[model samples]
Target: MKKSTRILCNGALATAVIAGLSAFASGYLTGAAPWPASGLTALATANGPVAGAPSVRKTLLGSAPAQARFDRIIVRYQDAAQTRSRPASVLGAVNAAATRAGLTGSRALAGHGASVLDVQHVRRLATGADVLRLSRGLDRGETDRLLAELRADPAVKYAQPDYLKQRLDFVPDDPRFDLQWHYTHPSAGIDAPAAWDTSHGDGVVVAVLDTGYLDHADLNANIVAGYDFIHDPDVGGDGDGRDADAHDPGDWVGGNPSSFHGTHVAGTVAALTNNGVGVAGVAFAAKVQPVRVLGHGGGYTSDIADAIVWASGGHVDGVPDNADPAEVINLSLGGSGSCSQDPVTQEAIDGAVARGVTVVVAAGNDNADAGFFSPASCKGVITVGASGIDGARSWFSNYGATVAVTAPGGNATSGSDPDDRWIWSLGNAGTQAPLPSPEGDRLMGMIGTSMASPHVAGVVALMQAAATEAGRPPLTPAQVKALLRGTVKPFTVVPPASKPQGPGIVDAAAAVHAATQEIPVDQGELLSNRVAIAGQTGAAGDARLFKIVVPAGMRSLNLRSYGGSGDVSIYIAYERVATPTLFDRKSAKPGTGEAVVITQPAAGTYYLSVVGESAFSGVSVLGVYQ
Candidate 1:
């Protein structure tokens, strides 16, 4: 079946607007080393069955002030077991049950759980259950009614509308950089107007988890407070407002500041901008909370888990409610390993999400398939990959089903000139200037998707701001994700064709503008990516590629635009010439946004007409892989 295509914000909107956390590229046009030699090749065109199915169970709400309580409340529920309706009706049934018990909403919160319930509207307000806010419209007694019903319904599992949530990262938009290319991707470095028409996300917080950040002039203002999760317990911080850990402050030096990756990532999210010095970050302004988890070399998964819990209001044994709790957690580090559904990793990530904090992760830089990365492959979290200057794959960014989207990480390390590199961010001011000599200043432009993830986190902040400006309605995680995806400026050419697959480069202007589009708009879906003779019109946006799952025995096909205004003359041939192929030509009158469809006469590996038209939109669909 043909699907409607979704268009997002044009690059015009990203002209420097003020807002919160933001984050989000690729390579050149050579031969298709990663893609098929022919322009149209087959790939796993359709989305496979979703892998993980994590459930959302809420007891306490996040916005309930640091004092509300509850044991558990199911976000989504049904009454299959009870053979009846859900919690609402269950409440009525339970009230009947409660009346039988001679009590109204007879129940009590279990332990110290009352201190953690809030988050009434969760669309983009909360990630999971950390901040559980009961429906404000519902009365206290209504809880009793539902409880009575839930406890009675044998079929009813649970029922709770997901609360809204807003998550982001720390970044600095210093405007000063050795080089900066605002390639429309927020992750490449947030771009928009200097001020907002309205303040959408004023009261939200984001936790940056990466290298320990250095104290820089650009970042001093955005920080709320943070902690060091680096392994060495001996390495305590200066305890002063600064995150100077007990360890000696030095460059990657004698091998030290590797831990500061956290700090760098933080700067990219909420770095103080317009100060006339360094670079500016995606989120023009956002409250950043630093949570250091990697240090001196690398860190163990255990410390990272604890850090996640602490970032949220959840207690870690005795580490009081973190000095700064986060509404969103930024995880820009990940290993090139398969996602092991291990309890620990899963729990930690799940716990963070449970608390209404959106978790954003990096897709890794191994240049391998996405299935090879953890956390990125983890279910629910926003997994982002890196692209380059020209909006091409970074040659090294991992790709696959798990990847949600691509951003400009800038391929500083990938051999592409300025064309491929990361969004410019901030470097730290050495604690004690380099003894004024050989050391010089430690801060320098670093590269990697590691550098790009925070940009998206910052974008999330902007989205939150957009919602706030619209009034504090529930902004669910699903909705936030949808907005992010739908807002993307679809790339006509695949990411510079470095990696095998790419969601295409991100466009911050497109993303923020995407927020302005209708809520339920379709983001467009692909049926397949395989082609036989694969080809594109010698022109720019022309040529159509497709995937056709060949049923059985079939070959030779005739295809044409389904709903064309008039008889169009397009071509059907092979690409790299030299051999027999199909679908390669120009068109006389492709018709104005005419509906096009290419079908196989029978079914087999083949390619069809390549009508040179501009743009990847129009109902006209392409097919292959058959």
Candidate 2:
């Protein structure tokens, strides 16, 4: 008999076995890494099994799953060395292969041209790959057959179904704008309203990865066309699988109503502001790209990863290239495990950052160390923790060395009865339990790093906009993180007091101000007898090279770097070079400092190079030689 695996549901035998085993063990709860046993239990109660279960939770509307729509496949050519310059040839090859594969009426066009293959659109990915969408819709079996035939072609690389993704927040003013204490509060908020004067994130695009969104009066104007990434119809809940439509159906699971999490996060980042209607957003002018990843039962890591790549204009097997790529990507969801250990998620993040997209993630809500959570712990990401009204850490916000900064997530510890203490944003009138309500849109309060992350993401949008307006290039992820850390408001008291919190509360005004200022690059100078210099690495991949002459009798050379906000490495070569590749000696440690000692120095002309590590920037470097 062939062994088969099925998704575990809350009422399934696997969940029953786990629950039964929980009774025999006291520390069973403690073994959960990212989530506490209570968190897992709550998740189980809200949807189903905490493990591998598809979301059975219903949203406020409690709609039935829609049928899969749009039968399309993504195909790549076999030549690995293909360049983006040859779009015509790529199209010709794909069209030819489609014809041979019996994909009747197939024709390939470049740059969104009409093709006989019903090629709805053709997107050239950053990887120099092409993604084509078929005009005809097919069932899963038919799509699989087409994909197999296309893959068998010599010119074809790989083909697969164009999987769908779910859409997945903020503060803006229509009426209850003042209720968002997380925006205007001096110590407890991100100081968004004040920063709005300098910049409102104009011309910036932020990708929100979460459950698909709803048609809200306040958010519709700001939402651009986004793709649904949900492939499984059961989990998609939108009645159909992946399509160009990014509208949120409902993700209510178990008995929980739709959280409208993506809408809430988008509002906080760039909802219409000063409209005298709802509430004020952090960056009111920024555009939001809703890439749905989570749906019923929650989303899979695989879907989430694909959304990341697509949102950043990278290629997915069957997805069209994102026309409006995001300058910043906000991820409010995460699971147990270190990002270093999870290659799939880490690679997506790295690829985004490589394309100059700043990634902001939420620390888990377990009130534990964030180092145990993924994406938050991922290198090159801006991990955010949450703070409450008292200017202290939220009781439930995760803390640890991995946290880059803290923002208002809100605290209901005082009580949820009063709306003042919680972080308020636009929401559907339906409650978590999903009740019939006459009211349409309303101000809802929530607490968690999920709520906190959008504040930072919004502020980042402001900074990026300000930088662009100043006629400066877009800031790299490393520079953004550095500026955020440099401008933070110091914590009154450490949240856990055991583990260190982030540098301080994120201050949008200060960050915008910093972005407007000019950054000076220092050039090192050589002394008469010895070479002593001080400099800084401005951004990731930045290399600061300086020339130093080994004195006549010098037999050894010592070089070192110290006192900087980010990790820096030292490289030295015997010849003048534009890059650091020709290094004779180098030192790359995992901290703010580095050192390299060369024994038998034969110096004609030695070049000292300082490079920034992943997302490492604005770190001061001091070079001393004896």
RMSDs, each prediction?
20.7, 14.6
Error of 2 at 162 (Å): 19
lDDT of each: 0.45, 0.62
TM-score list, all predictions: 0.51, 0.65
| Segments of candidate 1 deviating more than 4 angstroms | 1-178, 183-191, 194-201, 234-259, 413-422, 429-443, 495-502, 516-626
How high is the lDDT of residue 447 in model 2? 56
What is the Å distance of residue 410 in model 2 from its true position? 0.9
lDDT tens per residue, model 1, 214-310: 5665576777767765534322233332232412242232311222455567766766545443445556467888776544323334455667787
Backbone collision tally, model 2: 53
Q: Where does candidate 2 stray beyond 4 Å?
A: 1-178, 414-417, 431-439, 523-553, 559-595, 600-624
Candidate 2 residue lDDT tens string, 451-560: 88899999999999999999998898877987998899877666654555677899998999999888654333442334345445333344566766675566567666
How much RMSD separates candidate 2 from the native structure? 14.6
